[model samples]
Target: MIVKKRRRPLPLTVLSTTFVLLWVLMAAFPFIWTVWGSFKVEQDFFSRDSWWFAIEGPRTIAQTGSAFTGDGYYGAWVLRDFFSSVVNTIIVTVSVVVISLTFGTLGGYALARSGYRYTFWLLMLALVFRAMPHITLVSGYLLPFFEMNIWGHLPTAIIVLVAINQPFTLWMLHSFFLSIPKDLDESAMVDGCSRFQAFRMVVIPVMWPGVITTGLFSFLLAYNDFAVTAMLLSQPNQTMVPKIASFLGTIQQEGNVMFAVAAVVSATAPLFVLVMFFQRQIVSGLTAGAVKG
Candidate 1:
């Protein structure tokens, strides 16, 4: 029969798998290279064995003319300044997240539940501020803090970070709040709850995912900020992101163990924790919003 000549179909599954793998590599190449490079010695950073040239971390420093060695990630982690900066980053991120969520949730609930007409304009203004280039905002405010001796402490940075983060946070939370049925509010009031009580008991519980998402967004945004933190904070209180950048600049001429250690510890670790902690909530909140609309 003609079936005797049946041909095998092209291995589309293999092709699709290959394409997905390639895309993931393309998306993750920088992070992967950075992680590998974290294990490299500073002296080896520019060597032939360096990932900059070889697509993975350095294996040996040329200075020794001998075998490769370990970079001193252990020592870098013990560096008092590294630890201090890490503390500062954590404090900043946590503060921003909590404050942003507290304020954003309240503001969002008000706008969505109160039927305010001005919310659209307020939202537009928020988009404008968020859309403004980070460099420009940092530069514009730098002199006021650096030159004028205004609120030039860590508090200033916190304030600026929170203000910059709030608009989008409020908008995102507002969308989430709007997705909740108004019938819930009515039912709560019918059950002897006031507006504030209803929000506290009914709305807030259901909106926790959105609140968590906004908090993580704010935390990550504050934690990873470079220009703003650099401009606002200094010395022992400098945020980890800017400090890491400083380390990269100084290590350009040396063995990169310290830089690698700092890069991995400062930049990658918190982000990993953040993703792991709130990953499910983030997905659920985002998906719920999408489906609701």
Candidate 2:
């Protein structure tokens, strides 16, 4: 059967569509402009005379003998060694996600299945920690890190990021675990499986979506994190965000902020691809968490 909906008033429909289109253009214009400008020299992209210089690119043509140039990408990737920061980011984010999920899954499952009064208090404590500013938490670690001589390293950044992100993971996975019924675990246990075995075999497979969701969020936390990474890691060990930031500061002095622009575009591209690849899993995971069986 076909379903029909009431039509909106002409003025309201036009207004809504116009608003949406305007919002999309507003959101996309900066990135579209950045992508176009990344190929141009500073003078053309940041044209003082007319914006048409960006389109015509006379300077770019004069310098590179063509309208566009790969100088910025070459400068950042090859000359500046941006690939090291990319490697560091991958290591930190992957470590954070794996460690967070290892603990979060077990802790969340136990908390969700427990019948103790302390569970509520424990969750509230985690929530309070999660609600606190990340800088404050990072500040607390600085003194000890400096004393231990483990400050300014990739592992330190990963450890701090996990500490900051763990509470949120526990909370989210705890809710996801709650949405799962006890019968699955109980049935598995009755079939001669132990609790850990049931969790590994029966419960976890059904909770896979939730795990992916939590892991993705954990990945994003460590991936985009600036405070912990910047403050803890040394100059040689910076991640993508801080490295891009360093480009903004240093490239400005070199009179070619396009390096920073190029780096920004490079860093953002992977995140776009990652989200698209996980889109279905993310939606399903969110839906599973929201609805109870």
Candidate 3:
């Protein structure tokens, strides 16, 4: 006798869509609020004493028609200081990404190819380094460098920023290197490649996606950081995140147009462009490393 097969149920497409929508909303909420606040006058920002959202609050700007205004962004972009901050942020971010990725890739490769005994010691060292709070390192070097007349400056700040970003990059790239099969290294060596040459020629290309991913993360950390920058670089010519934060403290905070606009414009494009540039590589590298097949 032939038996009839039961049909499987449809996938939870609607539930999946709802979950995605919720996640997107949560992520986009702060950005939306910032964008909206950027358009409105300072009065609208401070006048609303309540935490809850409302369609309209007080008409602080005295605009006749819409609550949306370009005054804040306009103020931020019209100053030379704002542009200087942007330049500083770019410099720090580039330095951190380049240095971190270079050292991280080397350290990672070494850790990945070393024997289990070597790996344990290296892993312990990494853990110790990573576990040491940035505050500890910052404080340890703060006074010594300050006495040298360079700590409270841009050069020193960039150095500290790169140092703080290195440990995370080292760990991330190490994992990426470990994910690759040993056969690739063996095959490259059989083809007359030295160990370092094999790493440079073979592993580097395969690990490019991981490098880009980690670089983006490092760049973001360097670009958005305010604490180390504020502590290490106090000069007006130094960096932007601290500049923006400093501007927030001044009495005429409303007039700091360049600060507001620069904040909005800074991370918007580079992040989007980076993702787009490595979109395909990111997907392939992620899956290729994670899956056995």
Candidate 4:
């Protein structure tokens, strides 16, 4: 009986695994260190004696008789009213997702269905706008927003975010719509349903995977935006990202760096939860649009 030899793993596979491991470590270490330090007092965390002071939190042990404490969280959340920023961020993210998805679905379906000569040009124009730096667009809005006296309001920021985010939204949803067969809607139409009814009854249900993925991108844009929110929103109306930036300025003076650290951890928790729950949809949506029937 002749036995076949087992093949060894390729060098490229080993290298790729190593690279991925290193990248994950690099990305995860900062957040892990920040969370570890958040439980420490300022002195222990920033001490020159040893970086291990942060890990051990000796000062926290001496004061609270525990190596960890909730002071940082309490200070940032209760005293600093970080909840308000959280609320603002949630509102902006939800509003942007809803508005962007609504408009993007209708506009993208139209572009995908239409045989007009201008459709290609329209898509290219959207691509150009999407590629342009958002800051440039923010500048033009400043004057108009100031004139209308709507600068620094949540509604104004929501509207601007919707506008800035639309180009990418249209492009992504348009591609997803292209992957779907036009015959699907036509079949529904042949069954005595109107165009809108066909779309509502047949297409929308199948379109959700793409929509969820697109909405995730929209949420990230609105949630992670600091430049637009900082420039356009008033102090009270600021979102979590800008609020985090503001913490850096006063943390040193206040001698409460851990508060900022805690706030950073708090802010990151939601995104982690979001990914954990919807990662499957995100993957499916991305891959589904790449192939066409």
Give the Cα lDDT of each candidate.
0.73, 0.87, 0.70, 0.87
Task: Note each model's CA RMSD in angstroms.
Answer: 5.5, 2.2, 5.2, 3.3
What digit string (tens of lDDT, one per residue) describes model 4 on residues 1-293?
88998776799779988999999999999988887888888888888788889888888899788998999899989988899999999999999999999988989898988999899999889889888887888898899989989999999999889988998888888888887999999999999899889878899899987888999888988988877998899999999989988988886565468788889999998888988999997776566546531
Tens digits of lDDT, candidate 3, 1-293: 88888654457767777899999999978766665555555555544565332235345336536666555555564543567777878777788789888888888788878887977777777778878867677788878986887876666777777777777766777778878998998899999999989989988999877888777777777877777887777676557766766666663655464345445644464666766887775565456435732
Question: Could you tell me which residue pairs clash in candidate 2?
Answer: none
Name the lDDT value of residue 16 in candidate 3.
79
The positional error of residue 23 in candidate 2, measured at the CA in angstroms, is: 0.9
How badly does each model clash, as a count of residue pairs?
6, 0, 4, 0
Candidate 2 lDDT: 0.87
Q: Which 10 consecutive residues of model 1 have the lowest summed lDDT?
A: 49-58
Candidate 4 wrong stretches, greater than 4 Å = 1-6, 9-17, 284-293
Candidate ranking under TM-score, highest first, comes to 2, 4, 1, 3
Candidate 4 has a TM-score of: 0.91
**lDDT-better candidate, 1 vs 2:** 2
Candidate 2 residue runs with Cα over 4 Å from true position: 1-3, 280-293
Give stretches of model 1 more than 4 Å off. Answer: 1-11, 43-45, 49-70, 146-148, 256-261, 283-293
Q: Say which prediction, candidate 3 or candidate 4, comes out ahead on TM-score.
A: 4
Give the higher-lDDT candidate: 1 or 4.
Answer: 4
* lDDT, candidate 1, at 89: 83
User: Candidate 3's C-alpha lDDT?
Assistant: 0.70
